[model samples]
Target: MNAQTKQDLLISIPNLSGYDSETRVLMERACVSERGNGPVAYGACLNRQIASLQGAPGIPNLSGYDSETRLLMERACVSERGNGPVAYGACLSRQIASLQGAPGIPNLSGYDNETRLLMERACISERGNGPVAYGACLNRQIASLQGATGIPNLSGYDNETRLLVERACISERGNGPVAYGACLRRQIDSLSTLPGSQ
Candidate 1:
């Protein structure tokens, strides 16, 4: 993060402290831990924090701070952290789509490997693939789909990516010869109830 960015985030720190427990834990986890952290390191940390904060329920009402936060989060997830930003970034992505028990999930504009992993895991979980399987399931990432039951949370992804993910998730289920109808229905139902959507 630049000096200006740092100052901006610092100003929001007090607001962050007011967030609920889950958001606070998530924000802290976005930063990379190192005794020898540099500007790049600081940027990574800041990006993760911003991503988590933007996904919080109250972000929409945060007085335009949400846009600044979303930009920083995207820069970190898509550019700086590479794979490292995935875990934190994806958490915010999934939450962005839903964020239960609150006002709404804020709009997050970008995605990373972490967020893709989140989609896969969520798809798998909903498919009743109970115990998460590492290599046993799927590790692929998809971007967009036309009629996917449950829509993903990224606005910048192309349509093809969405379809790919939906297909990949289904293949990973490895269940009986059932149709895809139920899965799609559940996904649609779930997404319609997400924070912003609801």
Candidate 2:
């Protein structure tokens, strides 16, 4: 992150000492990488964390799920450290959708190898949170990739150049999938500027 962005984040969340080191790091990274809206993103993240920690009760009710599914949902949502209600509810919702065999979750089978690899890595990072959470993570990251702007089309590039671009993009992934996608976009844009890269 740039010095100015870092300064802005610290100024916004002046007392991050209460959070563990890992969460603090993730919070800062998520905030800064949130489509360049650091302060607003940080505030949202902070609110979520606080709400979750306090058991603020805005989470989805278990009225419809069966006993086993409700138990699984609770375990999946609470298994992750520092999970907020928004994320927890999202996990529950995804689990419900998965149980119903929902059709909207994009199939990654058709994606190019490099893009698939990055998406896999992003989801793998959430594997510890259980199957429901992992599925949720995959859905979220794939949506992010699909919705993101400026992702260059790689059909014109040869295998070697594509691999190089993939490695370059992954190397610049500072925090998570959003930043990784941004890096991929930037690397491809940089290639366009080269004299004979076409």
Candidate 3:
């Protein structure tokens, strides 16, 4: 090997494509993006993917965990199950609020406006006309239902996660709604002990 002329290197940042493509888009928007619009788009895209979610949509010739990750997230938050379902749907909502897009309302507690809104929404969900529904979300969120921090009730749901449950509970019925109510109870109890919220 001999050293002679110096070569200039050009790096190409490829475009994000494929199914869970929304995840890549969202992450990019979440980090480098300066405006809420970009993040908002990512959020909407993720939401659509979640809504039309059929297990995990497989993308041909695509690599990475975007699709799989989104699938896991949906499984945690979206899927329609009998009694055992992941609380990812609630997590998604909270995540949206925490992100650049769904910053939620203002003048509250936690890291940002989104966190506060999430807590308040949780309160409404728990204190409202449903405890079972809240439980459904919490079953997956709370660690053994022994009580958690940042949750709305007796549950220990993180800020963003609590908001996720609140969002899920907002539009559901029957067993789904009942589960949400339980989740809310868990949150309510948890929040009741928080430093500022409790």
Candidate 4:
């Protein structure tokens, strides 16, 4: 993937809290192998990596890892070959806690309907404003993700190009289509008088 796309994928990965710079870099490199796949595939790759890290010899404990990594490892261990509700619920709780600013809660689609409901309840109890916080956090995350795409350099664009660029920027910031169209209109109006406007 290109650098910008790679960065966007990285930002969308959950469970990164409390990682040291070096460990974070290592995990990013690990994710390189999982690129080009969508988010669910990437998450599966991450879970596999967590399982591998948990099983490696001489790393008996995950004390050196971040809390997020440690919690993921714990979840992996708990869910291994077991469908026990208590263990699953505990794992879900830890997953929720580890993902404070994640895009949203981890997908529970793999669970049965009943289990999914329980997990949602557990998440809600763990985070009182879970859905609201998730929306706000997702917006901030999108802004940061797009900020890495180097979209701010619209210096030499003509009116049409600037309008398209503005629409893209506003949309990537999570604004609605109406806002995007308005932004495009405003950009077209403002840039029409610029020195190089066509």
Candidate 5:
């Protein structure tokens, strides 16, 4: 990833500073890995690394949770294995709190079903990254879809090039809003300087 993409990924992690030193280091290392995966994959990698260091936490009883919630929790815990049990558990707890209207997570209830599902998928994609990372990830996705950031102007390009630029920008959506806009601006800059692109 480019610097802008890396920066966007870093900022999308909620309350990043609140994480312990080791966890923070793990996240940063994952961000720059050659795997070149999106934020969600990076988060999952972090979970695995943490689990490896700490050994997996024993499974907790899930009798109290409804089937859906229990399944969600089970999948989460199982995904992390024994890596960083504390971080993994805390992330799941934060998700539960968000569902219950806790202050940290945004109110996503009002969005259309499709948009809501996208946001939920965004969060789940980063499931093991912890509350702060996935919380911020969901917020960024919502904001991007809502057009909180302005799209770059592509009027200077021909139809074919413009279509390509738009598609390129959208492909960076997983990196968050900043990277999307940056991708557009980068394309505009690079393409405009080409001999015939003007």
Candidate 6:
């Protein structure tokens, strides 16, 4: 693709919050190298790369991926580290942290299910106990939580806090308590049953 077209493609992709200048340059190179291929084809290649990095299941069919979806896949791939699977998880956590503080992502519904899930988890995690504090302490806590063998004590947390933690664990980390869904369901049911709920 031409420089302008490449720039446009980069701009169109969502969840590029974690890519630094060097990473962006790499993505640009990848796009240029695959410029002969159509957008869909290029997107598919990027998605496959991401799947490899995440150790996720088979490569998704990217024929249906729009520019935005393709961008997310690209981000996923570019986030991969040489250290292996744990590094990939850490990269994702950092990406999620950066996106949490960014402006609201428009056309969120336009993203595919997986991308939507990622964005939702990021947003939920951003809603901390009180004001959102994107500090080292929070980052350390999230990292430690991801590495912990058991669930942390959340008894003192309110419904929102619990919900955020549960969603992050289930969706982002791929590890959550079996009762998480049931707990969330019960909370939702209780809220809806309360007076004035629609």
Q: Evaluate model 1: give its lDDT.
A: 0.42
Better of 2 and 6 by TM-score: 2
lDDT of 1 by residue, 95-189 (tens): 34432333322222354444444544544433221111221233222222223333335344357755654565575333311223345445556
After superposition, candidate 2 runs with Cα above 4 Å error: 1-114, 149-155, 158-163, 172-181, 195-198
- Count clashing pairs, candidate 4: 0
Specify the poorest-scoring 10-residue window by lDDT in model 6: 129-138
State how far residue 157 of model 3 sits from its true place (Å).
44
Q: Evaluated with TM-score, which candidate comes out highest?
A: 5
- Candidate 5 lDDT score relative to the true structure: 0.59
> What overall lDDT goes with each candidate model?
0.42, 0.61, 0.39, 0.47, 0.59, 0.45
Kindly list the per-residue Cα lDDT of model 4 for residues 33-123, writing each as its tens digit: 5657877576666555555545233113346555544554454534321422233334445544654655543444654453334334333
TM-score of each: 0.23, 0.35, 0.19, 0.22, 0.37, 0.20
7-102, model 3: which lDDT tens digit per residue?
111111233464354454443443343334454454454444444335632222223324533343344443322111112333544333332332
- Displacement of residue 94 (Cα, Å) in model 6 is 25
Q: Please report the candidate that would top lDDT against the real structure.
A: 2
Candidate 3 lDDT at 38 equals 54
Off by over 4 Å in 1: 1-16, 33-44, 47-198
User: How would you order the candidates by TM-score, starting with the best?
Assistant: 5, 2, 1, 4, 6, 3
**Candidate 3: which stretches are off by over 4 Å?**
1-12, 34-133, 136-198
lDDT of 6 by residue, 1-198 (tens): 799998766644433346454433444454455546766556655544444445433223334545543345335545353323334445545444554555323444554454344434544443332122223323433344353333335576687867665665464332222233345455545656769978
TM-score of 4: 0.22
Ten residues in sequence with the least summed lDDT for candidate 2: 79-88
What C-alpha lDDT, on a 0 to 100 scale, does residue 58 get in candidate 1? 30
- In model 4, what is the error at residue 97, expressed in angstroms? 38
**lDDT agreement of model 2 with the native:** 0.61
TM-score of 3: 0.19
